[model samples]
Target: MFCGGYQVQGTIFLNPNCDPMMDAQLIGGALQGFGCDKDVLIDILTQRSSAQRIMIAEAYGSLYGRNLLEDLRENLDGHFKEVMVGLMYSPPAYDAHELWHAMKGAGTDENCLIDILASRTTSDIFQLKEVYLMQYGNNLDQDIYSETSGHFRDALINLAQGVREEGYADPGMAAQDAMVLWEACQRRTGEHKNMMQMMLCNKSHQQLWMVFQEFQNISGQDIATAIEECYDGYFQQLLLAIVSCVRDKPSYFAYRLYSAIHDFGFHNKTIIRTIVARSEIDLFTIRQRYKERYGKSLFHDLKNFASGHYEKALLAICASDGQDF
Candidate 1:
């Protein structure tokens, strides 16, 4: 259920009575004149699904002869603007944009690269590659290569290939793979990177889960613990992310949400990106996992850390329907 690629466990869904033109008109009214109606923007955009939002964006462009993203860029500011603009794009385009922003500028956001490349499904990665190429006129793998180096770059490029095995997971092969991983963890040499990369990048998530279980039996250590002890820096984080996602993606994202809130004050960008990106994917499960893992609701934490329309928009996307808490 949590394997991604149309297995949606999200808080938002397609509105049954959605009207693109009407939504566009309402957005136009909110954005017109001196001060924007932040409440209207939040209400309409947060309620609609990503597909519906796309239709609304198309309708806005046709109705007003203006680009919705650009108009939003002009009208909104700060994190709220970022969230609204993020909502306007189709998911692939938004992901491409986020990846671009992460790699652009002086220092690379390795966390962003790991978060996306490690977690997205194969089909999602393929669409992201196309969108990245079309929107930025650059190959995503090439961009990643140019920005990163060593084993970290190697892991990212491999994931970017979007060729991970899918469908039935063979238990026997998983046991063999687990032995190979155990050997790699024991050696911790240059070839260790290659072995780990091959198993982590190529195996299906289900197979990887079995491998992790086998690995624990073989080494008396969780795969995550082995990763932490054997590797360091970005490569370590990326490997950990892949394993965590394979085990429980929603729980992985819940930890991310918790980190975004608590790590060195408020990581607004991470908060916005994670919530928006996962809003239509598995944020419902993430909310439940957050409470289970941290003994508090994600909404409660967000309410404590954020305020105003920005907070309202996030809460709307992460709302629990009165049951998750």
Candidate 2:
């Protein structure tokens, strides 16, 4: 999601509600500010959608607002800079490619690979793979295999392939996949752990939800129990989060915000990146759904779960209700 919604709907919606003309003016104003301010950049570009960023880029020349890309070139640094600049100029696909390049060859930059690959939508990953090959002359899986090792590599590769298409899958076929998942979970079988990793990262929320529902009914045990029975560490938590999210997404964010604050003991950089990426899109609905389901707002939960500046930023994002049109 974009910059999490703010305290005021008036500021977020304004008159234009992402009016490109207004976006153009805002970009110029920021670029021409007293000096390059990162706070300004994060404040403006982080909040605006890609279409608005494009308009600002296009109008920059006429307005002499400093070419958006050039300004970013001058101002930003490191991985955030790369992701933001790529997002500013092109679609999300190229940023995924940038992430791939950072990881591929030699020792493999696991951090970069996980950062982009872990949180993307299936369609986004699909498009990323297509563009990655076009840009790099190699497949994503091949590059991953070259860099990674063991079951972790295998699992990561499967996920990067985007094999779990979310829609129009035959329920019959999906039942079979669910059976495979369930049997893997059976303590007698011992296939549960590896399968857990595969499912958690690979399955889409919709496809996996079907699997989760049937597995619980058929196995007579809930999905969380199955996951707890099978896996551990961040991956287990991720699977649990997935199941929780399928039941209700806002609950998932609440859990995540809680884990970030109280459970994990801090705002992990990975969680931060993931939340920032998502807050622009699904987060608004997640907040609404959280309120509807929990009878307490997502923002309120963050206030309880987190503290300090971290709390302030996340709470602001929650209040903004990032999903609003």
Clashes of each: 0, 11
**Least lDDT summed over 10 consecutive residues: which range in candidate 1?**
1-10
Which parts of model 2 have CA positions greater than 4 angstroms off?
1-29, 32-34, 37-47, 61-67, 76-119, 131-139, 146-148, 169-178, 187-207, 233-250, 289-325
Per-prediction TM-score, please?
A: 0.96, 0.66
What shift in Å separates residue 109 of candidate 1 from its native position after superposition? 0.6
lDDT of 2: 0.58
Question: Model 1, stretches more than 4 Å misplaced?
Answer: 1-8, 320-324
Residue by residue across 1-325, what tens digits does model 1's lDDT show?
Answer: 4363425388888888789999999999999999999999988898899899989999999999999889999999989999999988888898999999999989998888999999998999999999999999999999999999999999999999999997658988878999999999989888888889878988999889899999999899999999999999999999999998988898888998899898859888888888899888888888988999999999889999999999988898887243437
lDDT of model 2, residue 91: 52
Model 2: lDDT of residue 204: 61
| lDDT on C-alpha atoms for all candidate structures | 0.89, 0.58
